[model samples]
Target: MLRRVLVELRRPQTPAGLAARLGVEREVLEAMLASLERRGYAGLAYPESPTCGVSCRACSLKNLCPAAASEAPQSPPVWRLTALGEQFVESAAEGG
Candidate 1:
């Protein structure tokens, strides 16, 4: 389940979307996301348009993005891969 979540999150998607994709409850997926975040393997998507520079990656507001919910009907924040998360996916795909 963890690996599947990690790989699927390579692209940004709403939490609800992710849960549906994995056939899990939103709360279940959210707990996994939070765990991955604490381990530095995943992160929240930036609400605003991508900005240049490394600082943008570490912005305190990264987890508080409002634009994530701007989509029609509103939804939870999107999840995305971190450097570590990407590495994990690549290695898994390569059969590491």
Candidate 2:
């Protein structure tokens, strides 16, 4: 789950945003995000839009997600990949 979240976060996403995309519960998603944050794999980014309550609301990648529309509006804050996250994904993809 964390690996999947890392890949999605490479673009941008919130705990709720990812949950929506993955068809998972917000609580489950937030736990994954928190784990990523603790491991220095992700970080939060505030939304630029005044109407966007959650930072992930404005993410361009949301449209491509299967579960994007299912998530509730009040999902937790957005999370983005940290440098470590990027590296981890790349290495994992390379069979590291």
Candidate 3:
């Protein structure tokens, strides 16, 4: 789950984006995201509505996320990697 979140964190993604990337249900993705948040592995950032391309707007299910709507739209979605998360990823990559 952490691995998946890290990949998603590399980009600004909605629940749908996670679902699609992870090949799981949106609810499952949401639960995993929540778990990551509880473990202090990730965060959410909502950016201003983009004026570029219709496809970009359709890329995420932002409308379904309450946290996304409550935050300032001007702020972009930022997934901060905690030190622990980074360490874990590095260790896993090194097969430690």
Best by TM-score: 1
Whole-model Cα lDDT of every candidate shown, in order? 0.70, 0.66, 0.55
Clashing pairs in 3: 45-77, 47-73, 48-73
lDDT of 2: 0.66
User: What are the candidates' C-alpha RMSDs?
Assistant: 6.5, 6.7, 9.0
Candidate 2: residue pairs that collide: 20-67
Give the TM-score (vs. native) of candidate 3: 0.54
- Candidate 2: tens digits of C-alpha lDDT, residues 22-95: 88999888887878778888766544422222434565555643324544333445567766787899999999
Expressed as tens digits, the lDDT of each residue in 18-90 for candidate 1 is: 8999999998999999999898787766434322113434554444444343542334566777778888899
Error of 2 at 70 (Å): 24
In model 2, the runs with Cα more than 4 Å from the true position are 47-76
The C-alpha TM-scores of every prediction are: 0.71, 0.66, 0.54
**By lDDT: ranked, best first:** 1, 2, 3
Between prediction 1 and prediction 3, the one with superior TM-score is 1
Per-residue CA lDDT of candidate 3, range 52-94, in tens? Answer: 1123245354454433444454432334344455566677779
